[model samples]
Target: MVGSLDWTAAGGAGDLLAPPVAAAVGAVADARAAEIDPGLADTAAFCEHYGVPMEASANCVVVAAKRGGETTYAACMVLATDRADVNGVVRKHLGARKVSFAPMDDATSRTGMEYGGITPVGLPAGWPILVDEAVAAAPEVVIGSGLRRSKLLVPGKALAALPGAQVIALAQR
Candidate 1:
């Protein structure tokens, strides 16, 4: 069980999310394992090195949107095979006139996750974590672990349980 296992077993950076987020995910049954790899700067390179099939991987991206002059963050989960329709679904979902991918600096700074290794698990609690319905339908999904070299293989359901996660049809075919 997650409680019995030393979560600190991998002694590097701690969970990216606050205690409650990790606790909620840890409470789920059969949550997949997290593996740390060497730091990767891009998705294709990370997938090749880790032998992770691109089809089975879900890419998590942080998009910034302005609603009523207030900036907000939305965590969009898209399949590696598909891209998040930021201008379409994301803009409509957030009711923003304009939205754009957050700058690299902003993403890294806020997430505590390196460029290519951002995962939904430990994201800041308030951000809306949207999962592409396709990802939720998969048997197993590979995702970032808040570290460039690390990844977590979790069941779709477990991913849905993360705090503030919403399953939506937000991926482009």
Candidate 2:
């Protein structure tokens, strides 16, 4: 119901989710999953092809923060119409001297998800999931299902309740 896609209980659609996502979906209340053409997984493409609004779509980006001799990884969720304020809000929030988008290969390997489908739902334990205030306030939003061929529909509040989730003003208009 998020767009033109047929949505079903995410807990019952393990086949469409990554292993970690399938395992973690049960923890997100009221989450729904819908299959889609993998080729249209990108935000603009998926939104346009499925008649979804940009405001209802959220993008999850992995960031690397380094301080001293250690590096930390975290996930940032923001509405598709906005952008994550990485070097500003995220770096300061993570308490890192530097912050940057994680390398695609590193992000994929560490998160165990496809490049374009990494999501906050199944991120490694202890990694923070920073959700923008606007995203957390939305009634519902579309995010990747940890796979390119499907998407997950979840209440913004549910994302804010995930373990390690922190709602803050992390998006730049």
Task: Provide the overall lDDT of each model, using Cα atoms, as 2-decimal numbers.
Answer: 0.72, 0.96
Q: Which pairs of residues collide in model 1?
A: 36-150, 37-149, 37-150
Put down candidate 2 lDDT per residue, 6-94, tens digits, no spaces: 99999999999999999999999999999999999999999999999999999999999999989999999999999999999999999
lDDT for each residue of candidate 1 in 1-173, tens digit (9 for 90 to 100): 22111223222324533332344446544555444446553667756765667787789999999887889888999888999999999999988988999999999888867777777877777889888898888777777666664555667777777778889999998
Report the number of backbone clashes for model 1. Answer: 3
Sequence-dependent TM-score of model 2: 0.99
Which ten-residue region of model 2 has the weakest summed lDDT? Answer: 1-10
lDDT for model 1, please: 0.72
TM-score of each: 0.81, 0.99
Model 1 TM-score relative to the real fold: 0.81
Candidate 1 residues lying further than 4 Å off, grouped into runs, are 1-25, 34-41
